[model samples]
Target: MEKFSFDGPPVGDDADISAECQRQLLSPIQEIVKAAVAAGWSRQDVLLAMVELSWDMYEKRRGDL
Candidate 1:
């Protein structure tokens, strides 16, 4: 992943911007969990898979760390 920094003017108050960022970040995970559940996956299994995937991605992104 590429590093990103906001160099432009502020879009909103910090609290509002942070809240929106949290919502945006979680939206995809919520959808993924919903789909997994709908497809008959247990919540535990889905959560474990999510954790594993997150760690794997983190390792990949932080190569040689």
Candidate 2:
């Protein structure tokens, strides 16, 4: 698989920050997911765990912001 890369928003461009952030994050995230699957972890389980952990983190951190 090719490594993901993002050039980022152009100078003075008002790109969607959330989308840009996701693009930047995808490369490492994909690497981790692929590695986890290769190491005998089922994709469904890994994805479900990610969703559960992410939701928990979001809920915990929501109060801070």
Candidate 3:
């Protein structure tokens, strides 16, 4: 399929919640990794999360290319 990119608002111009909230929202994802290590989550679970994160990042910056 063909893809197109949209021009986005300037960074940091978001009216959304503050950066602190963003950090808080994501901190748990890190904790989840450590806890999962102790709890013995399968390697597949950890790797799947990584793949999802990578794809999300690629989409986020697709406009730059």
TM-score of decoy 2: 0.71
Number of the top-ranking candidate, with lDDT as the measure: 2
> Which tens-of-lDDT digit does each residue in 2-61 have in candidate 1?
343433333744546655665665766787788889999998899899899989999898
Clashing pairs in 2: none
**Per-residue lDDT over 1-65 for candidate 3, one digit per residue giving the tens place of the 0 to 100 score:** 33433334335656455455545546555666777878988757986987799799999999999
Question: Against the hidden true structure, what lDDT does model 3 obtain?
Answer: 0.67
How much is 30 displaced in model 2, in angstroms? 0.6
Backbone clashes in model 3: 0
Give candidate 3's error at residue 56 in angstroms: 0.5
Model 3, 32: alpha-carbon shift in Å? 12
Q: What TM-score should be assigned to candidate 3?
A: 0.39
Name the 10 consecutive residues with the lowest summed lDDT in model 3.
1-10
Model 1 pairs in collision: none
Candidate 1 residue spans exceeding 4 A from truth: 1-21
Model 3 misses residue 30 by how many Å?
A: 15
